[model samples]
Target: MVGVGYTLMCEQTGPKELVEQAVRAEQAGFDYLVISDHYYPWLDAQGHSPYAWSVLGAVAHATSRIKLMTYITCPIRRYHPAVVAQKAATIGVLSDGRFTLSLGAGENLNEHVVGAWPHVHQRHEMLEEALQIIRPLLDGDNLSYSGNHFEVPEAYLWDRPETPVPIAVAASGPHSVALVTEYADALVCDNPDAAVVRMYDEAGGTGKPRYGQAAICYGPDEDACRKTVHDQWRWAALNWTVKAELPGPESFVSASDHIRPEDIAQLVPCGPDLEAHVSAFQKYVDAGFTDVAFVQVGVEGQPMFLDWAQDELLPRLREL
Candidate 1:
């Protein structure tokens, strides 16, 4: 089945607004919610980066029925796998089994804040080790691990949900796709890349769910929408290779200095055209994604987009 979800971008809004948006998203007929976890917003202009786990806990208490997930959280560096597993379990229990934990190899922007930044290959290795620690802990098992990247001594989750929390691994390449196939319940991608899904299937992930996220700015004023995205999300158009190595938001700002509004408009669906939004989501479905989350770039456009989604885009997607 194809599922449509809403994205809660913590980088742009505070915890209170995020909780309110979650409630509105569910009421607007969204099937699930995907929240981004970050220590810093990509651009200083985006402003806020509330602790995603704390905000998610509040969202759990505030909303019922809608599934919640971290769009992607890095388990290494700033957070230990054991701690992440425990937090995920508690959130799962709080949300009544409507929670999923999405993992990524991580970028320097968030991980560097802790003063420990590994090489790209090393980061992937750390993620694999993290999964080794997280999976069993979420199963309510007490265990110790001695990996090159991390060590845990008889750590166990005391408040795990009756059912183990589901894990969705975010993958943009073949290596990560293979990694997720072995450890995750689902595969998540930011782009509508069919080859990533195909690689996951070839690596023994044929029946697992594939989740995708796409960003869009929906507003009546085209220039205003483009300007907002250009200012807040121009970093999105940067290559992952560059994004992975950037140390902080200031570096991102310097890197995104050349990105123009027209460039962003070309990449992201901007303005109030229903077809533009519909087509953007359709690309994910056509790419074999079972679930897709639309991230609204303009914070003020959220309610309007949700209304349009509930009344227009969702029904069109359902017909697909």
Candidate 2:
């Protein structure tokens, strides 16, 4: 489907602007809206962080027809699955049954809030454990759950929507993909390349919904687009994905380990043409993403951004 998601770039966007953008996104023909879940924005990176749940509440009222979701909420870190279940249930009702909970264990940067649990694969393990608790609870329970990572006593959501909520898992590996295939209603991937799509299908996922995401930087001058992208996205350069070409976070870190400030110049594109930007998304569709979201690269071309994407790409993609 034609969906839109934002990464919560703390640098230039905030909750208020996010709602405004969401309103426009829906009016502009977007069917679903997803936002990233991060406790704090990277200080050396994008430099802006707002509470995601509060922002989602605002979005629920700001747009009437748009579906809201966490691109991937980290239920294994700070918040327990029960808490997430409650919050997600509230949002689902508030949105008139239009909320989906996209779950993930968490990441090193967000979960590594020193003084807290310090581990890499803990979130994944916690995720599997949490799901076992969550599915039962969502099916209607007021009982306590005692898992290794999280424990609760008689916690329950008295106010839940009538329809059963769908959980979309953000899976990147074989085990996690299999977990999503077996348990989750949908699966999400950031890259949505051919190989990434293959992972889900190979894991035994049939016609389940799978979504993909990518960012685009289109402007008048190619040099300007690349420069702006590098300025704000230098942090992404630090990400491990650039060099190793592997899907893990370590590869992102490895790429960042060797990436110079100028390296992103070649990696990110600067196609001022709307057709080119739309073509970028076609790769995702060809690779088999049932849903695709685009993070607009820079703020300079906001109007041009919507004008191009909505008119040229959205109509054709709205059918997906």
Candidate 3:
């Protein structure tokens, strides 16, 4: 069966609600759960950004059957690669090996807090350097490394899980995809772009799992769903270059000022239509993603959305 998952958007929800949602998602039959690791919400209206690692720890104790992972965490800045490795190892122990450490080249919005944000190319290089440190340390090696962007004098994970935690890297362009092929155990992407997957496979990621996220606003009222998405996630319509370069939520809000509520439907499926929701998810399945995480956009209707997913959506997606 294709693995179906839910995302706990740490950028938008408080820690308590995030843990509750994890439990609810598991009960609703999701195979896994992913949480975003963000220092800021994309827009002020979204209104909640908490430390994801702490929330994941609570989630580990709250849910037993569901697998857990960061949708994508950046080890390149605000966190050293060694520290990221230690955090992943602890989460792996807490979740009993259910955690997958998904990382990215990072967005300025999150990494800028450290007072230095590199260009895209430099960021990729830093990510490769980070993986060099992270992978071996997670595998129980004591690491002392030096690279253009970082240095690890001597670091080791003392409480790693029985198995090495799987590492995934998010990629959208050719350069990032190359990094994924070289250093990642799995591939992660925000969109259902087959070309990205094909590139990863042809570039030596042939057998690795491809992971992607699908965002939707599921509510009884279609117009309400659309409005909720525009209010909370319209920043998503901005291209990757813009999304990665913006430094904060204020910047995103201004950049997304031109977006209208209806425009969101083109990017994210909104409303209660089961076929519309299923079709949006099928794009990921068709794109060769082995695991898909469903993001219920906005904070208001999550419980309702989970019930809808369990009662209607999951079965329909399984047929795909």
What are the Cα lDDT values of the candidates?
A: 0.91, 0.70, 0.91
lDDT of 1 by residue, 191-260 (tens): 9999999999899999899999888898889889999999999999999999988988899999999999
Model 3: residues with Cα > 4 Å off, grouped in runs: none
Quote the lDDT for 49 in model 1. 94
User: What TM-score against the true fold does each predicted structure earn?
Assistant: 0.98, 0.86, 0.98
lDDT of 2 at 32: 79
- List the RMSD of every prediction in angstroms: 1.0, 3.9, 1.0
As a whole number from 0 to 100, the lDDT of residue 203 in candidate 2 is 74
The per-prediction tally of clashing pairs is 0, 6, 0
Tell me the spans in candidate 1 whose CA falls farther than 4 Å from its real position.
none
lDDT score for residue 227 of model 3: 90
* Candidate 2, number of clashes: 6
**Would you list the clashing residue pairs of candidate 1?**
none
